[model samples]
Target: MTPQNTAGPLPPPTERRRLRQSRSLTHAQLAAQVGVGPSTLRAWESGRLVPHGSEGETYTRLLTTFAAEGVTAVDGPTAGEGASAVEAGRETPQAVVPQPLTPAQAFDELYAFCAPALVRQNYLLTGRPEVAREAVERAFQLAWQRWPEVARDRDPGGWVRAAAHDCALSHWHGFRSRYRRPEPPPADPADRALLDALLTLPPVYRRTLVLYDGVGLDLPETAAETEASTPAAANRLAYAREALAAQVPALAEPGELRRRLRPPATSEEVRAADPEPVRRKAERRNVFWTWAAVACTVTIIGATALAVRSAPTHYEAPIAPAQAVQGVPPAGVMGPLSREERALQAKLRSAAAKGPYRLVPEAR
Candidate 1:
């Protein structure tokens, strides 16, 4: 396995890449073996489909299996077992790579899962934990905006990581900007005093402490995510826990900090509100249907106009004399005016003459 190398909030792509590479099959082959389509395999490999909670473990297993067998399920030995099989077959069997994926290619799949967390990671680092979020977000977007350059690199994750460090450094350089979002002092007199004391701690230590203790990443995981060497990750995790425990009373409570990191109920579901491609297509269909409706309406209107123009004029029938003069006396509601207006207002005149004439105002 690769040494712990990152401490960013996003899940470490490095570890995933190592796991993916350990296998010896292409992505398409793995998908076939796993009963998934080539596109599905690509999505999983590219890290576009992020699994929540147990899904992470499941992905690890799935990807590992695929890497070993290809998408087609013609299987053999598992990791350690496969190595042993190789040793045994050395005498006669030719060395064959059944499954293989490159580190850069694997990381490409991983970026999406951790993309959003780029912001969260920054927020956790630096004493101005509030701004850490913006820094990470900006860093990730900037990296993404330059993806072509990133893709060209052999270690794209490493490249993006270097970019993240540059972003963090810029934040440090612009310390004055941090003051704009002045941090609220702790309310308690003792705690406030301790909080002030915390500011004097070294920047590196503070970052390590906040991530390992403030956030709930286990030391190794934190180290790997943060890009720290294994020993460094462990040391930072220990020191941060100790420092925070010493300063905050609740933090000293058994598992208090850990509980704080995650609420009691954590469903293994990511609230990915982004619509799937299928949904987008459905929306497009609705738009096309709307246009089709307008076109049909225009067609019907045109047909009606054409029929009216084409049809021969003919006098079919006339209303009976008594029925035409039914109730109203021809003046309209305004009462009779002249013979020209009155001739058309015969019904209105009749209604007006009847007196009650309670006309409701129109709603327009």
Candidate 2:
């Protein structure tokens, strides 16, 4: 694949370093990108050692892939069904944005900032207690891939809420679309008259109502996250309220609606639970490093023992203490002296000038 325009960061120093930078990248998105820890990344940024090998290569691909996410065409269907017009020429693209933090750092920051709010929004929107959990999981998964973009925004929780809502809607749409079914409309007489009409309203109207009143996200923050103009967002929300009121009878009782939107109480243990993304990533890294440390320790100890065992070792007979030298073993006790042994023993003794030497060698 063509490398992403790494030429933007640090002046495209060299192809080798460019390649290394690519591998070192992480986005504020999906959790899969955080193979290394933040400390490691800091070390890399401060001109310490660069990450190398296949892992580095993976990082590089991520960097380049998003370099110009002109990844997919940014167009939609137009009124003219047969229009084939296309741009004949283009001006040079603007300087790339400051390279965002690697995906891991963004994930940690963004998830913490957004997840709680998204969970609340999920409960409010869907009216199902379990959906809040799934909504948070899926939202951050999408945000994990775009962590840099999400974290850089003024209100990350709002961004997260939109992504989470989309993920949940996509999930539901996929399920319903495949089944070729829609839920039976609300049954209460007031809802039967009004809620059915609300469902008939446009998507923009329904979504605006869900987000503004149902999920309790403010228009300005919601507009930023959803990429809607302020006037449009405000107007759509207004229209949505009218439609929802005109459509659903259950919506008439605001207190009842609020209670229905509330999530069921979870046990303290569950309430205190870590996000699945963070927990799972931590667990995976912890398990890997724990085994790695153990394996390395075991290997070093084993190697040292092996080296000690294989080393050349000569067992020297203990010298007799001067006072204890009264009795000594005879020379012929071990074996008859060979001429070479005699010569070596004589040489050794002559050097020390010991008297009446009767040296015996130990078994080889």
Candidate 3:
């Protein structure tokens, strides 16, 4: 097969470390690019720790680029020869093409890498194991639904973290009976006290503390993720620290507080769902919403068409109202006759024999 055909997406952790070696780049050189210490990057490659936050994102991107360029593993004489060439003032090792991965492979790798820590962090946010699991799973589902956007994002892990945190802390949970009851506190008194103190702070303060302290994110990164100004994020962090210190005296010092803010031992109770199910669920939900929109559009069109068909086509003139007739005599019973009428009646009787007493019409 051709080198381009063999090239793949980001490799597993071991392969990534080997790929770096194949490129003859030292830990210090790569750590500088990732904005972290060499020891941290070493831990990441050794599988003793997983990189996260902005640093993890940078690392993921760097590895992705390396994969896209088809970096290949080199060992023994090949490695020594590359080092010799470098000592001889060569710019870079000879490039070797490698196999590439599909988008699904990359997504699965990202999910496996981020989900466990996210679940633990979300549990810290909500204090409920079930809710934490639900939040992480839901966030993954959303990420899958918008996979292209997430894959193109600078920090896909952070994107998922924000969604999970928002879901965990949503006020809507209060209305559901399933979530109304509180979870049991940690068995250790100190852990329980710390959790209570954390929960007592406002959600904004709580989130700031978790991002800045619990997740080991720098102030600027925390601020950017929280969508707040640097000063606002600082103030919230300070307020959260003060509240936590007031309740848990052992954590009064910043160093001690940061140490204590690591995922609590009890967080093992929260387990994230597998990535396959989340992806399937996301696809189904997208399809359902698409059909729902289509149905609504069809209903609206039918109603509009019916209205147009039944409406009046032309106008008709209205009739005029009734009025009283003029010059009409009021009729009921008749009154006495006038004198002229009586005189005319007498003349008629006196002049009766004129011509068989023809009756003449008289005005009365």
Candidate 4:
């Protein structure tokens, strides 16, 4: 049977299976042709998954090509019969399978797809093409060294973008910007004005603005890459937009600024890219310093508490009544006593008579 037209809605799973059968191609064969895993093709045929983004478009194009080519199944017994024959010790003609791309090949493809856009993103951040080129090159070089880890990442491009951003913000760039002459303005008046306005903003605001508007990252992603909280990123984006609008009224139009600032390439369009490099080293150092400071603080506090708890306390001994009165004269004085003293002696005699009295000889 002839293949269905691809201009209409996507063919159902049954139709895909029929088309594959008509072409005498196994699931693995078709998947290899399309540069996807055999399981992915099986999922598409089973209706368990639907391709999206570039994958979906690729599927449509492949299906269209398959229909146009009018490939037909070779004359042969059913697959079950062939398998049974093989089990019975009968040899079946083997089909040559396409080899999968190696890791190096995959890395090359990924770098080719993502490097240009990443370079553009860095350029926007640093306002210098040379700095941007160096940053992107450094990031890709690191990715090449850690290809396995980077290949497994879901958003490898994001990792590379963050690394390049850090490189652009490195201290060397600051020194260079201070000592070197500023680059000439662009020929376009609007472009020149926008660049000038962006340069005037604080680094945090500028980075937030470029990441959100120019790089097409969502608020949370921008915040993560910038190492800011979501709320803080939102605030920065709002302030940056307002500042840009004030300076360039044309930017006040919704999406106009984003359109003007956004790079020609997108992360979605380029599914593969490099890994993060310098950020990991910086993060490790930061973690070590933080733990060291915490340990020192806890040690000091514990020592202070132990010292206070184990400190010695002083107490005074109680004095005997006789010793307390040793410096005073006897109750009966030789010389005339003051009126108040005589009254005190009379009160003391009364108390002494009521209780047991003790007498001590007067000193010579």
Candidate 1 lDDT:
0.50
List runs of model 3 lying over 4 Å from the truth.
1-96, 263-268, 315-364
Candidate 2 residue-wise lDDT, 1-364, digit = tens: 4333332343122543454344443322211242433334344444454544443555456445545442344344353432433232223224444466665765665566456645655443443335556767766665655566865664455566676777655545445543354444333454344434544667556566655544544566447556799799998876765665555555556544433332321111112125555547545666787899999999999999999999879987889766655578777667689999999998986766555465656698
- Range of the 10 consecutive residues with the lowest summed lDDT in candidate 4: 265-274
Q: What are the C-alpha RMSDs, in order, of all predicted structures? A: 22.6, 27.1, 11.8, 12.5
In candidate 1, which residue ranges exceed 4 Å CA deviation?
1-112, 127-130, 152-162, 169-181, 184-201, 209-233, 252-364
Better of 2 and 4 by TM-score: 4
Residue-wise C-alpha lDDT for candidate 4, range 122-156, written one tens digit per residue: 65666666777778777766676666787777556
lDDT of 1 by residue, 271-303 (tens): 222223323444466678789999999999999
- Best candidate, lDDT-wise? 3
Sort by TM-score, best first: what order?
3, 4, 2, 1
Window of ten residues with lowest summed lDDT in model 3: 1-10
lDDT of 1 at 350: 76
Q: What is the total number of backbone clashes in candidate 3?
A: 10
Per-model C-alpha lDDT, please?
A: 0.50, 0.53, 0.78, 0.69
Q: Supply the global lDDT for candidate 2.
A: 0.53
List TM-scores for all candidates, in order.
0.34, 0.35, 0.65, 0.50
Candidate 4 colliding pairs: none
lDDT ranking, high to low: 3, 4, 2, 1
